[model samples]
Target: MAAIVPVPVVDDLTSPGAQQSRPGLRASQSRRLNAFRYLVFALAAVFFGLPMFALFRMSLLGSRPGTYSFAAWKQIGTYPGLLGSIELSLEISVITFVLMILLLLPTMMWTRLRVPRFGRTLEFLCLLPLAIPAIVLVVGWAPEYNRIERFNLSGIMLIWAYVILVLPYTYRALSAGLNAIDVPTLSEAARSLGASWATVMTRIIAPNMWQAILNAALLSMSLTLGEFTVAYILGYNTFSVKLVSISRNSNNPVVVFAASAAGLLFTFLLLLILSYVGRRRRRRRA
Candidate 1:
């Protein structure tokens, strides 16, 4: 009233021009967000992918000047203990996975159905391994392993040791899968229909949690395949140990790179096959 100053209206705040500009502004923002996401993905790819690319390139380079050859790969078969180490590693991984499924799956399922209160305690026990260093674990096991060696095969002991290492991860995976499905309800229904405990577990629970089981198995295998410390410290000749020895002994980088590339490629293919199989089963179930 004093100055007769104009006051802004709400309508003026969202005028037709402003309304028209909003869609364009939103579209510009959306494009920018998409571009930023793509840039991040590209950067991430370059960050992780460049090293692998370089390793592959180095793997292809021949030991001699002005020459390129796959002698490194060819020589893998001739490495005295390599094939054995690979076989042994595969054996360990398979045995560990089987034992895990047989032991962990059933026990976890039972606990989920019967002793819900103890679930937290069980989880705590499983996670204790993560708190203990591998060196400490190996050191603790050394005396016991030496005693067992007198009577039982060390391979058996190795599998047991690996089980301890892989248990926490395997249990978590299975627990997640169990949680996703109504295991209690399923068990009740099965039991009402006169399904035995074994039948209920094998047919009902196992079929439903197939993906989780496979995931856990894959993780265990991957760990076993790449494990160097446990095997080395325990004086076992596994694939990783052999690879390390090769790297240390051979001056040529080609052999080391070739072996590494082979292992990486093989693991990729294995996972790819497993993924395809899992998808196929899912489609069938659907």
Candidate 2:
């Protein structure tokens, strides 16, 4: 009599309420997530790009209050020390590239691939370079080098300095790459098939990790090519040094702007190349 009470049956696979609720919930989540991503991207662009854009505008305006001209650009290329500085920078960057590879290679292999005590020690030591400030490094090296060695140090010192400075960047990249690969498994497989560690590293590991290595190289190249304090301290008249000298010594705003614009464009081009390669490599890896 109690009004013929009845119990509701729960649907196992197909339920109208569940099915209807899911699409709406999914749609709402997707919209919010997309909106958040867009917001983050916009904020990042504004934060990083706005200052560079401002510098570009300043360079365009040159020394003049309200006019634009190409005179600055002409002066930039035609400057007396520009070629020497560029060559010097190239030399430094190339040397740094070589040294960077050498320094990073072993660290990558040992730390992530081997993971032995010696490898750990090497990693800890390598990290010291990153932990020390550039100014501090320059200071320490200068006194000890000049006093003890009593030898003439030229741009080569700065070149090595670039190597030291960019070591941390390369190390992290390669280390990450090594971690991504199955090192111990690869080694045992190669060994069982009658391959030495050398062959394993060069043939298998290095090739697979090539993209990360390249990424590290590009980072070192970009950083070393545009360094300032170390070059100045070492008394090397590099491109960045000449650019700063030009800007500060005289009111040749046009030339300064042109030089800045050139530097920005060159770096941007390198960055673009690196980004494209990195993306392609990532996709291939995936």
Cα error, candidate 2, residue 193 (Å): 3.8
What TM-score goes with each of the models? 0.84, 0.77
lDDT of 2 by residue, 1-286 (tens): 0111111111111223444234556777877877897999999999989888877776677445788766666776677887778888888898888877876696567555566667767767766765677877888767655663357545655766677777666666667667768888887898899997778888878987876777677777777888887777766788888877877887654566667778879978987766676676566766
Residue 38 deviation, candidate 2, in Å?
4.8
Q: State residue 130's C-alpha deviation in candidate 1, in Å.
A: 1.9
The TM-score, computed over Cα atoms with residue i paired to residue i, of candidate 2 is 0.77
Off by over 4 Å in 1: 1-26, 152-156
Show where candidate 2 strays beyond 4 Å. Answer: 1-50, 62-66, 110-115, 144-153, 284-286
Whole-model lDDT, candidate 1? Answer: 0.77
Candidates' C-alpha lDDT = 0.77, 0.70
lDDT of 1 at 141: 86
- Per-residue CA lDDT of candidate 1, range 188-213, in tens? 99999999988999999999988788
Q: Which candidate ranks first by lDDT, i.e. highest?
A: 1
